[model samples]
Target: MSARSKKINNMAYGKLCLLLLILSGLSLTIHAKLSSNFYSSTCPNALTIVKQEIAKAIKIEARIGASLLRLHFHGCFVNGCDGSLLLDDTSTLLGEKTANANNNSVRGFEVVDNIKANLEKACPGVVSCADILAIAARDAVVYYGGPFWKVKLGRRDSLTANRSAANVFIPQPSFNLSNLTSSFATVCYKLYVVLGLCGHTVGFARCTSFRPHIYNDTNIDSAFAKSLQNTCPRSGNDNVLQPLDYQTRFRFDDKYYQNLLVKKGLLHSDQQLYNGNKADSLAKKYAMKQGDFFKDFAKSMIRMGNIKPLTGNNGQIRTNCRKPN
Candidate 1:
């Protein structure tokens, strides 16, 4: 081989290496922005502290509502105590409403307000009131059998509320199982019905017993009606939750499917994943093979948060979370 040809080959090889290196760096950058895991060497402690406080407040409020409902419905009747039906804030005058109060209707407002006030006092301008409510509502849902995913902080409140966004974002209680799954998928949740059932079954089952009297509202009876009436109620209240229980409820897992297996999964789609041929068959497959669903759930969640997020200096870094000027 000629020396000139050899030198040309070497040059081409070096160029290829350089191109690959650039691509690797680009991939890392994109990954960091997309997920970041709320972990960063350069993450501001103040930011982290604020985020933690926000999450804590949200989690606390959710659990509080859960406890309140649980206490209210102890040994309830067939129609249950209507714990959910009783949740309302029509009593509060609109003139005195706060961001958490007027914008979103939390089940337990008084308790949520106290914590919100504490955060307001501690960090007046650093956090957004919208996020406080969003995270709190999310945790409350988690408290009610929905598992938690890491909520991306740094989102600012809307100056003018988008009613369309609100109306479109939240799923209805009366939504069927297929509709529920479709709604989640419509919002790009990347939910694999089969992948989530393994760890979800137990929690879902407990959720079932939590509202034995909550037969009609939400997806309570229809989804898990057969399992709830057959195994859960027959076995007695003490035997409601099983040993493989995933308790945190804050973390995502396959328990959703397992939950379907044990309780009255309220949604038609959810029930289908357990017994029917489509998604239910897939869920049944996973119930047998215990694998991790976190990776998929997390990836999907990050994508959810990123939807229409402020990027490239488009939004402001508000010193005050409310009433951005």
Candidate 2:
């Protein structure tokens, strides 16, 4: 072909790619119409129902709050927070709940079930499971002393769960700084920063998740590693729990960033934020100014919750969170 023809073809291809992206964006969110008062008319008690269930669970075990928040974050990564992560494994579908990243790590399904049962009773098919999950995460953060933001709703439940996507999208505890940044991309590294500071502030990691850090990693403080080594160890006790923040594991604060400043991060991925990188400055700022961290965290949560939500006639509203209708 002539060079002029080739140039025309390339320009046409570029235009086609851009047009496809534009259409994709419209299909995903053009009709989302998410708002803080989305449920005021349809299900007035939607947020309240979710908050009550989360509070009841947190009352039983404070760590359950973290689990719910984690559920929301993980769900956002794969297929844009369509509640696919909540689906139970079945003969026809290998759901995300059983995926490598979520298998034994993610928890608090019972609390979600309780919330869904109540929501169904009050307003059957009015609220989407994805929206409930997002609201539950916000309520958990507020109940645990983190910043509160109005969670926009209107998302619909995904009909199918992509287990393969779950395994690939969710960031692992063993990731380094570069991995963390790239994994948290599209939404920007700031999402990683706020989550690392806010989520880990109240969350805990499993012994297996941090064993490599406490044993083989050199960046961690010696005393901190030694202490964790006692709780976690070189082998066995895989389910043993260790607080992400050694000082205050139940409070959602900037102390998780502070811990990183002293090389006391509980997981290999946690310390990556403070280790001579672009994220180091962010970690330092949050460590020194917790109010700023809280403010940014609240904003980031809202932004993260809105990514590519299924709306309009795109997805269905699942009655039971464990399965689609």
Candidate 3:
């Protein structure tokens, strides 16, 4: 009931308000760091532009959806999802397209270019190519009957590409279980490695990449291998292509895991997941549950998209995704 008591109570209340303000600011900073609505204000139509471009491309060639998804994975796997894979070779910069894992193997560059061009027109210099790729990947999955997830955005394009790192980091088809596990572990957890392999459920592999498996690998089914060998010769015609999943190549289902169960997985790297290792149980579990595969695939993709993103002035918004500006 005195002036001294009233002053002390007022001081405590002011201190509590200050503390709450600081905590609220920190929470917002973290949330805005990487968010699905990153372009809601800056480029309100960014997601729509990306989805429209992806749908057009998939309509032209359904396989393109898988290629676009693979592009995101390859880019994120090496130096995070910075659109480094989209870069073209230059006098000073040697890009990842020339890497052994990517040379003549990675497809759908034109599709990304199409999306970038449209986005630039809609909201010039607003949406980064890295964010476009991430959103395009989610759209691609939905176009192909796969489960959808909200892609975290605000990633900026990297100023440099790592050609050597791509070769060393990206998993190769010839890789066995040990090599495959180590390759994916470099960028993501062992569990994600399995989910990443599940992406194969929608794509096809070139005959050049799978010939040895169909002809020499003992784990593959005899009839299935013979079927592939009919098109993929032992000696020549390396450019021929075969669906990665014999059952449903275009559908983003768990048939890839089912093929692994039957020793019919098209690639040596794919079968290795079920080759009596820690991943074998996961392979079996996914093989029996399509819903589980869809759920985990969506979760792993969001995690993969979050890897080492360049945001908050860390990198530039590239006008041409292939070159830094």
Candidate 4:
């Protein structure tokens, strides 16, 4: 190729890279706004304190890791990782805790409170609850054997929680692949939805949330459906739990994709990814390549954590995670 042709090709490549960076929620400007070392000087021990607390919680109960991750995901989805979901029901505010998607489902708030208290003792009013959520989420995934990536900090807490936004934003178990993609589209791309759902790789879902899939969905394997039917009947037993990845419920791995490939996915939305659709090939690739899944998952987590965060003077750093100062 001529020199001029090579130069034009390089220019096109640069533009493509820029587009990808913006679409993936990793714009250079956004990275500048939030940094991995945001608290290096103000609170040098912030990350350590969070990691130790998360490790202790996960050690006590392996399921807590998933719970902590879920808390962060839900909070981020509704209010841009602002810790609004951590808020209790104030006299005039309806917290995201009671939203349709999170009510009685999302757990591990006590874990956040513990981390916040420890951080306060070490450096009072130095760390933001929003940043705590982000770091705790990364540590939770790491504790469960998932990939680790630097969690950009400097986020501030939201003064109010939005129950309506939570219900509308957080993807539900009943969602189809298209719905999931649509839900994530405003904040991320299709790949983001696929990788983000890997949160199920380490967590358990309530019976009520997945009952229809087991009892009525034809896509699920017969044995898998029959096995869950006893515990999750046609009626009642709403809170009975079942691991999302039946293969390795507590382990953070690519078994989620493998499950979908075999019609054993525990949720309707999960199976939707593999029904001879665009996501089918992607699922097969991840099922066969655990390393690729981990790498993409870590990137997706960082991208998800970047959604519309309140930085600089836009929001306050709350002393108590459940209430704004």
- How close is every model to the real structure, measured as TM-score? 0.47, 0.89, 0.88, 0.90
Question: What is the lDDT for 302 in model 1?
Answer: 35
Q: What's the TM for model 3?
A: 0.88
CA lDDT scores, all candidates in order: 0.37, 0.82, 0.80, 0.82
Model 2: per-residue Cα lDDT over 1-325, one tens digit each: 9998976765554434324432332122333668999889999988888888888899999899899888998898888879999999888989998777788889999988999999999999989989988999889889988888999889999999998988887888899865655565544555665664458888888898899988998999999889888867688899998888889989888888888999999888889888886567778888999888887777767777887899889889999999989
Look at candidate 2 and give me any clashing residue pairs: none
The best candidate by TM-score is 4
Candidate 1: list runs displaced more than 4 Å: 1-43, 51-157, 181-186, 189-253, 266-272, 275-277, 285-291, 318-322
Query: Residue-wise lDDT of candidate 3 within 97-188, one digit each (tens)?
Result: 98998998898988888888988888899888899889988999898898999888889889999999999988888888656544554343
**What global local distance difference test value does model 4 have?**
0.82
Q: For candidate 3, what is the lDDT?
A: 0.80
Question: After aligning candidate 4 to the native by TM-score, how far in Å is the CA of 234 from where it should be?
Answer: 0.7
The local distance difference test score of model 2 is 0.82
Residue 17 Cα positional deviation in candidate 3, in Å, after optimal superposition: 42
lDDT tens digits by residue: candidate 4, 1-325: 9998976765554444424643453442252378899999999999999999999998898899898888888888776878899999978998889888888888998999999999999999889998998898899888888899999888988899889998888878898755665565555435344445667898898999899999888898899899999999999999999999999988899899899988998988888878886567668878999897777777777777777788878778899999889
Better of 1 and 4 by TM-score: 4
